[model samples]
Target: MYSLLGVRKKQIAKMLFYENMTMGLIALVLGIAIGSLFSTLSTELLLNLMGIPMDIHFEIPMNAVINTSIVFSVIILYTSLQGFRLIYRFKLIELFRAEKQGEKAPKNSPILAILGLSMVILGYYFAYNFIDYVEKINFLMLALLILISTVGGTYILFHFFTVFLLRHMRNNKNSFYNGMNVISTSQLLYRIKGNATSLATISTLAAVTICSIGISVSLYSNIEDMTKGVYPYSYTHTVIDANKEAQVDATLEKHKSKHQISHDYLLKTLEVKGTAHENTIKINKTELNENTTITVISQSTFKDFAKEFNYNNVKLNKEETVALTSELSIKIKKQFGDLQESNNTKVTMSDGQNLYTYKIKEEFPYPTKNLFSDTFIVSDEQYEHLKTTSKEEITRIINVENESDSKSLTADLKTIIDNKEMPLYDYYTPYQQGIEGSGMMIFVGAFLGLVFLLAMDQSFILNNYPRQTKINLITQSYIKSELQIKK
Candidate 1:
C-alpha cells in the first residue's frame, strides 16, 4: 500500500515536472506568437488613432512569434542562472539541498517581474502586426477569447503542474495550510476561481463548447461549387476559314508581338465523320457562342491530353472509331461502350420521297475535344475526316502576359499590324480569357471554413450566455457520506 502511494506520488511528481517544462516553452512561444499578432495590430490601432487611411493586402503572422519566444526563453534561463549565484550565497546546508522546504519565490520580485511584464506587453504589441481580418484588436471578442483561453489554460496548467506536484509535498506543513489540507487544492481553486464567477461563466462556456466553425465552412463550399463550372480553362476569338486563318494569324501575331508573347500556339481541328445508330438522327451542331456543354474530346493529342488529366491515354482500335469519356457518352445519348467502340451507321436522306442511302461509320464524343463543347474523341484518321467541317482555320491560342513594362515590344507589334493592315476583327488577350480558377479556390476555402465553424458550433452556441441555477445541498448526512469516501 505504501509502495502504491509512493508510485502515485512519483508519477504525479514526474508529470508535474514534465508539464512545468512544457508550459514554460509554450509560454515562451505563445508570448512571441501573440505578441507578433498584437504588434501588427498595434500599428493599425496607431494608424486609426492618427486618422491614416490604410489598406491591408498581406500579413505574415511570424514576427511576434519570434520576439516573444526569445524573451520568454531568456527570462526562464535568467531565473535559473541567477539561482546559481544564490546557491553559494545562501546557508551552507541550503547550498547542498535539492529544493527549498517552503513556498518561497525563486528570486527577488519587483524589477524582474516588472521587466518581464513590460517585455511581454511590448513584444505582444509588436507581434500582432497586421490583420485586416481581425480589425480592432481591442474588440470584446478578442479580449474574451484571450481572457477565457488564458483562464482555461491556467486551470489545466495548475492541474498538471501545481496540484500534481503538491502530492509529493503533502508532508510539507508550512505550504499545506499547517498540514490540514493541500496547497495544490488551494492553487487549483485559485486558478479556476474566475471561471466559477457569474460573468466569467459565460466566457468559460464559450471557450469549451466547440462546433460553430463547421457549419460556416460547409455553407461556403456548397455555394462556391454550385457556380464554379461556368468558366472553362481559356478561350480566344477563333475563325475557321483557311484564308481567314492567315488573316486572323497575322492579326494575332501583331497582338502577340505587342504583348511579348513567347509561346503562341493553335489547336488542331479533326474532321469527324460518323452518324448516330439511327439514320433518323440528324446531329445538329449546337451554337458555338452560346453552348454551355463541357466538351471532353479525344483527339490525335489524346495521349498528351489524357496525361495532363492523369487519366488513361486511350488507344483506338486501329481501325475502329475512337470513343468518348463515359461522362460525355451519357450526355450525347450514345452507346455506352469502352474507349474503342465499332458501331455502324447509315446516313440516309429521303430524296423527294425516294430512299437515298449513305453508309456512315459510328461516331462518338471524342471527335471535338474542345473545353466547353460536347466531349468528343477522334483518332488522327478520324480527325482528318472531321476537319472537313472546320474547312477554314485551326484554333489559334496564345499564352502571354500584357504588362506595363513592355512598351517597346507593344509598339513594334503595332507597326507590324499597321503593315498587314488586316481588318481588326474580334480578338481576345489571354488576360481576358483566363479560367474560373479563383472561384474554385474561394469555394474550397469557404467549404473548409464552414466545416471548421460547424465543428465549433457549440462554441458559438455557448457565446449566448445561459442562465444556470445553483443548488446547494445542506444535508449533513449526505455530505458526510461523500466526505468519508473522499477521506
Candidate 2:
C-alpha cells in the first residue's frame, strides 16, 4: 500500500525498519522483566527443595541484560534487512498477490512412507535395548543414532506417510464420495505436510518431558528404600573396646525419651584371604582370589539378621557358605547375568595358617559391617575354628524407632562417643540428604516439563495462525460477494 502511494522503495524500507525496531524494543523490555521474575521464583523454589534456607531477592545481572539486548538487537536488525530486501525484490503487484498464493502440495511416495516406518521401528528397537548398546557402543554415538532416526523418521512420517495413507484411502469410491470426507482428508494432508517439522519437534519435546518427570518421580518415591539398602541399619559402628560400648549404651539410655532403641545386635567378623574355584566369585570382572579381603560372618548371626531384614532365608550345614555383595555388584550382576550360578563351586579362605573350604550355597546383595569387602557366611562351627587363628573384629548394629527423625539423638550420641574409638553411622544424615536431592530433581523435572509444554503450545499457535487468516479473508470475500449480488 505504501509503495502504491508513490512512496520510494528506500523510504518504505526505512518505515518498515522503524516499525520493527519499535516493536522489538517493546518486546525486549517485557521479556527481560518477565524472565527476571521467573528466574527469581525458580531459584527460590530450587533452593527450598534442596532444604536450603535463604531469602531470594529479585535482581537482574547487568551482564545478562546486556547480552540479551545485544542478541535481540541483532535479530531486529536482521529482520529489518529482510524487509528492505523484500521491497527491492518484487514490484507492488507481486507484493499484493503474495498473500493469495497457496503452498504447493508435497508429493506423497510409498517408498518414503515405508522408509519412515522402518526408521521409526529401528529407533524403537535401539531404545528398547539401550543397555546392550551402552555396553557395545560409545554412549554418544548411540545417543546420536537414536536422536537422528527418531526425529527424522517422525518428520518424514508426518510429511509423506499420512499423505500416502490418506491418498490411498481416497481410492475407495464409497468413502471418497462421502459428505465432507474428501475435504477433511485433503485439508489434513496439506496441513500436516506444512507443519511436519513442528509436529515432529513437539513430539520430541513431549517424550523428553514424560521421561524427565517419570524419572524424577520414580527417584523421589524410591529414595527411602534406596537409603535403607545403603545404610541397612539405623546406626552402625565398629566396637573399639568394651569401655566404648558401655559409653554408647549409656548415651542411648540418656536419650531414651528422645529416641528408643528398637533392635541391637553385635556382629563379629574375621577378615581372611579368600579364593573361589574357577573364578566363580568376581567384582568388576576381576577374580576375588587375588588378594581380596573376605569378611567372615557366622551362619547363626547371618540367619538372625536375614530374618530381621526380610532377606532370603538360607540354612547351611557345616562347610556351606553364602556370599553377600554390595548394591552396585548386584546391579552389575543383573545387567550381565551372574557368572557363577552353579551351586557346586567352592570358596577357600585362609587365616594366615589354616585353610578352610566351603561349598557355595547362595549369593545375596546385603550391606555388611565391612564396607569395602565381600562378606562370607560360614557355619558357626567352621567360624569358631577360623576365629581361633585370626583376630575377631566386632561391629554394633543398632536400629532405633523414628530413625529418620533421630537428628538430635544422633548429634548427642556423636558428642558422647569419641569417633576415634568407634565410627558412628547415623541414618538421619543420608535419609535427609536423599530427600533434598530427590526434591531438587523433582523441581527441575517439573520445570523442564512446563517449558516444553509451553514451547509446544507456541509452535501450534504459530503454525495455525496463517491458515486462520486465510479462512477469515475467504469469509469476508464471500460476505462482500453476497452484498453485491443482493444490490
Candidate 3:
C-alpha cells in the first residue's frame, strides 16, 4: 500500500527503523534508572546477609555507565537495521494475508520424539550416579555428556514431540471440537514450531535458577557444620613459653563474662615426619613420596579429649593406631576412593635416628587446623617410646560458650600472641569467612534467578503476541462466514 502510494522503499524502512529505535531508547533509559536507584539497597542487603559488619556508600562508576550505553546503543542499531531489512523483504500481499494464512503446523517424526525422551532419561541416570562417577578419571566426560543429553533432549522434545502430540489430539474430532478445545488445539498446533525455541529456553533458565538458589541455600544453611568441621576448638594454639601461656590464661579469665570458658586443656604431642599408606600403594600425597608431618597423641590424652567433647571412645592395642584427618581431606580422598575401611593401612614415623611403624585400625574425623596436617592416636606404651626419641610440642585448646560471637576475644588474643612463636587458630575466622562466602553465593544466585525469571516472562509474552493476534483474526473471519451462510 505504501509503495502504491509512491512512498520510496528507503523512506518506509527509515520510518520503521525510527519507531523501533525510539522504543529501544525508552526501554534503555528506564532500565538504567531502575538499576541505579536500587544499586545501593542491593549492596546493603548482600552485606547484611553475609553477616559482614560494615557500612556501604552509594556511588555509580562512570565507566559502567559508558559501557552500558555503548552496548545498548549497538543493540539498538543492529535491531533497527533488522527492521529496515524486514520492510525490504516483506511483500504487501503476504502482510495482508498473514491473519488468513497463519503459521503452518510443523512436521515431526515418532523416532525423534522417542530419542528425545531416551536422552532425557539417560541424563537423569548420569546425575543420579554422579558421586560414583566423581571417583573415576572420566568424570569431566560424564559431566559433558549430562549437559549435552539434557539440553539437546529438551530442545528436541519441545520442537518435535510437542508438535506431534498436539497434532494427534487434533486428529480426534470429538476431543478437538469439545468446548474451547478447538481453539486451544488449533493455536498450539500452528504456534508450536515457531515458539519451540523460546519454550525450551524458558525451561533451561528455570532449571538454572532453581539449581543456583538450592545450592546456595544449602551451603548457607550448613555454615555452622562446615565451620566446626574445619575449626572444632574455639581457640587452639601452640603456646611454648610459660609466661606467655599464663598471660593468655589471665586474659581469658579477665573476659569471663564475654568469653566464658567451657573447657581448657593442654595437649602434649610428639611431632614427626612419616609416610602413610593404604596397603602397597602410597596414599598421603598427590606425588605420593613426600614426607608428611604427623602429630602423635597418646591414647590417654585422646580418651580425655573424647570425654570432654562427647566423642566416641575407642581402645587401641599397642601396635594398632587411630588416624585423625581433616574433613576436606577426607572428602577429597573419598571422592577418589582412597578413604575406605581397611585393616592393612600403616603409618611409619621417624625421629632423627629411629623409625616406628604402626598399623591403622580406624580413621576419625578431627580438626587439625593449621598446626598439623594429621594426628595419630597410639597406645600409652607406644607413645612413651616415640616421645623418648621425638621432640614434644605443647598446645592449648580452649572452648568458649559462644564461639562465633567471640570476635572481640579473638582480636584481644591475637594482640597478645602477635610477634610471638605461638601459632594461633580460632573459630571466629572460619565462621566469619563461611558466612561471607555463603552469603555472597546466595545473593548472586537470587539476583540471577530474578533476572532469568523476568527474561522468561518477557519471552513468553513476545512469543505469544503474533499467535494470539492471528487466532483472534481467524476467529472473527469464521464468525463472519457463519453469519453470511445463515443469511
Maximum-lDDT candidate: 3
Q: What's the residue-level lDDT of 377 in candidate 1?
A: 50
Please give the lDDT score for candidate 2: 0.77
TM-scores for candidates 1 onward, in order = 0.29, 0.78, 0.84
Candidate 1 Cα deviation (angstroms), residue 441: 11
Q: What is the lDDT of residue 132 in candidate 1?
A: 30
Instruction: Flag the better candidate by TM-score, 1 or 3.
Output: 3
Stretches of model 2 off by over 4 angstroms after superposition: 35-41, 51-91, 125-148, 191-194, 241-259, 276-290, 303-313, 325-336, 339-345, 370-373, 401-438, 472-487
lDDT of each: 0.41, 0.77, 0.80
Clashing pairs in 3: none
Q: Please identify model 1 stretches exceeding 4 Å from their true place.
A: 1-233, 240-263, 267-319, 323-369, 374-393, 400-481, 484-487
Which 10-residue window of candidate 2 scores lowest in summed lDDT? 281-290
- Tens-digit per-residue lDDT, 386-443, candidate 3: 7776778887888998887888888888887755577688888878888899899899
The C-alpha RMSD in Å for every predicted model, in order, reads 21.9, 5.0, 4.1
lDDT of 1 by residue, 1-487 (tens): 3223554434444454555557678777675656556666655654443334576433655564566567777776665444434433455555445333434322223443344344434433433432331355655665555444445444344333333444435446666655325533444333332332433344334433322334333433443222222211222334344675565456546656555454344554432332324445554333122222222233556566445434555554544334343233434333222222334443322212232233333443332222333334545554453344433234444334543233344344334332333321112222112212333333444445555556456654563323111111323455577789999
